[model samples]
Target: MKYFLWLLVSVALAGSISSCRSTKRIQTAISKKDTAAVVPVVDAKADSMRFIHEIYQAIERNRIDFNTFSAKLKVDFSGDEGKKRDFTAVLRIKKDSAIWVSITALLGIEAFRIMVTPDSVKVLNKLDKVIQLRSVSYLQELAKVPFTFQELQALLIGNPVFLDSNIVSYRKNEKTISLLSATDIFKHLLTVSTDDYRLLHSKLDDVDVLRARTCNIVYGDYVNKNALLFPTYRGITVSEKTKVDIVMQFKQVDFNVDLTFPFNIPRNYKRQ
Candidate 1:
């Protein structure tokens, strides 16, 4: 009886080991397969303009799942061709129109903190120990955080704001969504997904300005938990060659929470 029990135990242990190895192998293969599939789908572009519009439609129809989110942003300023600014920001977004962002370099020095709500914009230069609260005017100023003030608000609340303007003679080159801006400053372009409607990438070019006016952005790392495509990652570049990458990973998201804005600046913080 003892000999028989020993044999059974050995066989059981061997089966367990074989099962574990098989599971690991399967998981690795799945990972490779998924990566391969996602790469091409993201690259496909029937027409950048239509893709962007489709993305707008998807977000418009699917904005129901937006709530709250948090992510780390990476900004890079140095590019080989002297075209971009090198900086990275890690951003945490709450659906209440609130955002907390920290910007730094690859070496992790010179950190900047920015916080924005529906009515207030607070920028803190942690390295300088200075803070500024100002009125919202995003169309004029460029940053890795908010594409535009309206978009910032939407991002803070987990909504899509890229749909603010209509498609006025959209253009694309398989990898880009170009929108002719009515304004003199912005030449808009955005990269979108095919299998689903999500803004995969975003970019803007100045019609007449030189050097410092162009921007390129890529959005990825989608987490499809709430029946919507939530961009878990975002990258932005200014000036073309040197890239400022902003990376974000969403953590907590709450939907339909009562959010209010005071827009009141603190009396203590100094104004620039």
Candidate 2:
């Protein structure tokens, strides 16, 4: 139960290869911001190799090129036991630097403040006045995902988080490209838009099959921010021993913006 919010925080915490000639050219087009709302022309007779190239190009095009990002989000969460809650959250990310979040509940009271970096994770429970300082491994244990801070940042920013470069199989349809990979512990499915290569959805299921643990994420509402497309809305669902669903909508978004990360544990606060 103590790990509940970490899973949610991981969502808020905010890949791959090549193909043939035409696909390389398409990447150049995307980087130049020439293809606004342009969907690539899918070849009906394309083979797995060609399709792989196209998929990689699209994935590359969707990568967010930003030094810093800050957003005010409306966060809603629900659980399998019919519990619901809402909080106003401020999310700040410095590319490859850190992710800082402040969650406010009733009357604008800050209930929790968390800061995660490449090396450590810090959480201050304002309600209990307890501070939890943990190593990055603690988070890996809590979430049961072999992810780094960079991976969480990618997830929050609507980018592909964990895609196996050596894909076993893939399916390409009119609107989406789906890639699949199987490991001993988890099976991963990543789906991206056929048009812009923006990630449309991602899912991870426990290989235990009988245990029924999974994490699903969906990205939507792409908005152009200085010629770069970013998702304005995100939905994450994780089902394990406990079920948690989180939805985040960016009310205001800014990029390459000057930001301050303020995290001060109170002097009287006890460390947990």
Candidate 3:
């Protein structure tokens, strides 16, 4: 049951966000879009700014500024022990504060509970009757990559994560817009819908040829939540030494409603 519960944690919050630069030219180009030609203009400065504006606008559109978020999810897990399993999870989050998750297994049995804050993380393993307390670095250890609490929260709320604002070039098509950036270790690519600017996909690959690894996340089935559009379904695949695929479907979601986060460990439970 420890392995089973850890799978939920690893998949739920294993990624991080990346950071951006110039504003004058970009702002001028954005303001001139009304007068610019419609037939795919060849001006490099104008086009680059246009692409940047599109991505920037999309990120803003997908942003969720709620004080609290609570959702019920139907999660399907694969690539763990080469077997598949389904679990129901209730996720509660307070913006920039903490994240609380409860996983229910067969027969609605509560198997695991997780609480993560800016400074620490706590896991209650009901099956083993043990609990683990660790610092924020626990996420980095679990994913074998640098990640933060806010990045995980952004991903959960369907906002853009791990995006680089230093994008100077882009590829555009009728259906999608692609942005690329290279870091010391990874080359990242992000694609979005040209129609509504919703995030379609994001891919990251190790730059070194000797080290082959990739992480891909896809968002779909967008729906409106109080004038804000959010993805209802998300698929995440991480390929490193091994491959893990996680599918999440949000059955219900509520934002900024009164809620409580309860976490209590039994006295008899052991600590590890």
Candidate 4:
């Protein structure tokens, strides 16, 4: 069950190639014709810089701003050991303040309730009748990254994470634009829609050459709520020495709504 909580946090935490070919005959003809024709020298660097600026502007334009967020979602999790679990999770977030989650098992029985703040983390395991409390640093230890409450909030809210200004390369097609950025911690490859720049996918790899940590997150099924484009479906995979996959489908979602996070530890529950 503790592992499940880790997966949940990781879920909040966590691309294609194309080739073009030219025929030999076409290449030969172009070579002969271009002998007399002066080819225009394209400034590749300037074009790339312009495109990167446009991408940055588009991302800012589509960024979602909300006071509160609430969602009821179905979570399916699979671990490296071939264990699979499906459950319902209700999540509520008061932006930049607190995040509350309740997970329900079969027959809608409450299994675990979690509340996280900027400074602390609390977990109530109903099945085991135990409560675990730890500092926010515990999440960083588990995630193997400098984790923070703001990062978690961005993940849950479907905002970009680990994005760097130093975008080294980019690829664009008719449907999507992919940007690759390198940082001290991660090499983040983020893909977005060509039309509106909504986030489509994100891939993260550890910058350390020896570390084998990677994560992939895909966003889809976008719906417009209160003029905000919200992704209702998310698929996440995290791999290190082992792999864990999680799929989340939002059954219901609302933004800027009144919310209450009721959490009370039972007297009989043991503290761990």
Per-prediction TM-score to the true structure, in the order listed: 0.52, 0.81, 0.82, 0.86
Question: Each model's RMSD to truth, in Å?
Answer: 17.5, 10.0, 9.9, 9.7
Q: Write the per-residue lDDT of candidate 2 for residues 169-215, one digit (tens) a residue.
A: 67667877877666766667677767668777666666675776666
lDDT of 4 by residue, 5-99 (tens): 57656654442211111222111321222211122222337778888878977897788899999999887777788888788889999999999
Worst lDDT 10-window in candidate 4: 17-26
Stretches off by above 4 angstroms in model 1 are 1-56, 64-67, 71-97, 102-113, 124-129, 138-148, 155-165, 169-184, 209-212, 240-272
Which digits, one per residue and each the tens of the lDDT, describe model 3 over residues 91-147? Answer: 999999989999897888899898889888888999889999999887767766667
Name model 2 segments beyond 4 Å from true. Answer: 1-4, 9-46
Number of clashing pairs per prediction, in order:
26, 3, 2, 0
Quote the lDDT for 243 in model 1: 32
Ten-residue stretch with the least lDDT total in model 3: 14-23
3 or 4, which is superior by lDDT? 4
Ranking by TM-score: 4, 3, 2, 1
